[model samples]
Target: MPQSAQLTPEELVEVAQKISELLGGKVKFAVIGGAACSLVRVASDAEYRGTSDLDLVIQPNKSYNAEVISNWLVQKHPKIIRSVEQFGVRIPAIPIYRGKDEYLVEIEIFDVEAWPNRQQYNIADTASNPMTTLTFSPDQYSGSSGDWKIPVMHPVWLLREKILSQYEREGSVKERTDISDLQIMLQVVDPKSLVLSAHNHVTALQNLMAKRPDLINKLRRAIVCYPVFGD
Candidate 1:
């Protein structure tokens, strides 16, 4: 028999925390990707499937020169197993191998004002819109890091991201993931929820729905309202 060591959700969150601290706590960004589901501990019930890398979207404190941000992110990443390249085009990535498996720790920094775009963001807490700071608790025993106990993006926000990605980076391999993601969002949603979700993504949704209104609309109204549960 053989034994193995893997980081838990808590450990992953700790990595995000450490990065935030090193960056002066200016990381008021939402967690994204499958890892986000683990850190926020929202989507998946299976924990063993979680560890691999940390994906972050940092809302910058000021105007972001993409070069500076990219450089800073690459340096902060844990280790470089190999240089990064995607479809002959280089991407920023580092590989980590554990036992028979190899993994990449990916860091993606996004500007707060620019990343989410207009028809996709809605986590607006009207608190004078000041630049936010960050902090995290590291628990060695649990193996979790970052904010892995919250819904990083509402179900709808994800739909919007998928929609935008589809158009912005069409024919790219990642588009397949975007399509799959949209279907998942459709599964978790219903009609009213769809509209509530679409209010921000109508531009994207309208086009998608025009093609499959029956399917999309069916989901749009499928969710049962809880307040009148007994009615």
Candidate 2:
């Protein structure tokens, strides 16, 4: 398979909107990974580093798993989408194209239930928590040609995921970007709120804290660096 080109933040939103439309309103999904960070950055007016592919976590219903969704998507729009390619084995990803022959970004789909350590991270509530669910308006941030409201992984959860990724993929090329994203999210999210919310998954929090002590220090510094002033 040829390497797909990178997509700007705006283009990512445009592609997300198309995917949402294709999936229809019944399917529940949220944008995660670098694509989610791009949306958050655009919404926060922070600089967005383009992402190579969009990561989406979908809640498969009785009828739809990653494979089923991919097949359905291709069947729905055969001309626009070339094909859905399966990648990886442990945590398989379905990469769906957004164009016929050439595309800027690829959409990588993952089943939320099948995601590794789903219970540890409590990832099922990714879109359930209103606080951690960011809605990206195309008109406001992307200037896209639709009123599409994209569901994104909010900074609090995103921060946890990034820290985990940093630890898991240590010394890899992606680790640097994960660290950079963590820095950006720290500036945007409330340390106190994040810590309080983390209590819901004590074991996961403990494991992460134990594995990545530097992240704990970063969170500690975040409290002082971005103090919340009371009115």
Over the full model, what C-alpha lDDT does candidate 2 score relative to the true structure?
0.63
lDDT of 1 by residue, 49-157 (tens): 3545555555454643333455655665535323355456433544434567755555454444555454232234422121222233434434555432322555444
Pairs that collide in candidate 2 are: none
lDDT of each: 0.46, 0.63
- Poorly placed runs, candidate 1 (over 4 Å): 1-24, 33-42, 45-55, 62-95, 100-102, 112-151, 167-175, 187-203, 210-214, 222-231
181: Cα error in model 2, Å: 0.6
| 10 residues in a row with least lDDT, candidate 1 | 126-135
Compute the lDDT of residue 20 as modeled in candidate 1.
47
Clashes of each: 22, 0
The alpha-carbon RMSD values of the candidates against the true structure, listed in the order shown, are 8.1, 6.1
Candidate 2 lDDT, tens digit per residue, 1-231?
A: 545667766667677776766776756777788988877887778888777777777777898876677666667676555453445422222233456655535566777466655642234554533224445666654566546767766787777677667766767898778877877888788755454334333444444456566666666644332222210
